[model samples]
Target: MSDLSRLSLNQATIKYAGMEQAVSACLRAEIPGIGLWREPVAEYGLRKTGALLRQAGLTPTSMCRGGFFTSPDSDQRIKDLADNRAAVDECAELGVPELVLVSGGLPDGSRDVDGARSMVLDSLAELAPYAGERGVRLAIEPLHPMFCSDRCVVATLGQALDLASRFPAEQVGVVVDTYHIWWDPTVYQAIERAEGRISAFQVCDWITPLPAGVLLGRGMMGDGCIELRRMREAVDKAGYTGPIEVEIFNQEIWDADAMEIAELTAARYVEHVL
Candidate 1:
């Protein structure tokens, strides 16, 4: 296998592509792995999707998400746990080893960030073992602080690691996404401390004047200010010898040809990440 064997395309990078299209693009690009999102997998039917991936020799590096346990509503919290449990089951069925968890931000009209974080821990305590039982590791993904108000309160790798440390390394781990945590001053140290708890490494360049809601503004590699190679080296030094998934969420990229996007992503991985 070539060095690019460690490169994977996250489905979100090409939101316009269907599962079949994405899989075909990955095969066309000679990419070995992919990161899947829950909705698409469900839409494609879990068993069928798993079979397709296996037949094509494609590995599902990780699943998109299985968390949102920051709601102050008791019923909502219960429902969130139930949904996460189902996500864990899907991970097992799809043979995915990692299920990324994006801890939701503060509750509606609330300033209690601490309370929200505590709820994440509480939810994990219940879901971690449930996931572990099915041989799936729950990966806590810390989004950028800009998303701390509505998306994910876990805004740093250290915060993710701190939460993951509460459980066994095999049952819980942290996702190191450069797009999310690149500006963090202590990211390298956190990577080192995450030694055995690094579950997935996602890459995307950071750009300014983020789009309206700031959800679809990620720049392609080499188009922004993040030190991509430096971050890759840090994750490598931390003993994470897994796929470096390119997870750009830019609308412009999404509107491009899916196959071309895959090819460009691979080339960018070579130029900026490897």
Candidate 2:
């Protein structure tokens, strides 16, 4: 078996599990790392979650998201900024150095993707320093273009890198997720450019016949068309030697037992991504 030391199971891969169950599954699989999201962590209580991970000998490889920065309403924008700062604080408290960001899509009915992207950059400008001060790095995750209207406006690794470039490497970085980035022609080049700023690497695959609600379309690695191993190599070549998180979003997978899902992810990671 390939060394499983660096395989981090992203919490969403077993989305139905409670925090305790997620940590337990990671331990059972001999997975050394996990990618945690704020909602479940919040629901479980941070101190308790921390204790559990510490007890299980699992490191939190990354914090799953702290952005939605494209709000047009002044009041909402203020709230968003404050929430980002809070996110930074949470990462610091939990000792997670990387805080992943999914830049929100166009504010309701707005056609200006350019405008939405600009807002992402602006939000980064404000968020980077705060995160940096707390020893937390903002890792921008560019979603696939299909999500540009409602999920994330940052649709290409190049665009994410462009915004991240405006800040110091320590303050801002980018994520390399195979499921979302595999289709980009310039993906390899972008990975090379990310270099020292590549914060986290997440793995999943893209399959056809996406579910009507597309948010859950991500396939488990090796079950779809993504060049999972190639992407892992590129990120490694770019100097990202951190955790490779398994982050599938299929409801079918979620409906399975968490332990089974975790074991399956580890097996697929070794077979398809190692």
C-alpha lDDT of candidate 2 relative to the true structure? 0.92
Q: RMSD in Å for candidate 1, one decimal? A: 1.1
lDDT by residue for model 2 over 170-214, one digit each (tens)?
Answer: 999999998888999999999999999999999999988899879
Best by lDDT: 1
Q: Write the per-residue lDDT of candidate 1 for residues 1-274, one digit (tens) a residue.
A: 3478898899999998999999999999888999999999989999999999999999999999889899998988889999999999999998999999999988889999999999999999999889988999999999999899998999999999999999999999999999999899998999999999999999999888888858888999999999999999998998999888999888899999999999888888889999
Note each model's CA RMSD in angstroms. 1.1, 0.8
- Model 1, residue 205: C-alpha shift (Å): 0.3
Model 2 misplaced regions, further than 4 Å: none
Q: What TM-score would every model get versus the actual structure?
A: 0.98, 0.98
Model 2 weakest 10-residue run by lDDT: 48-57
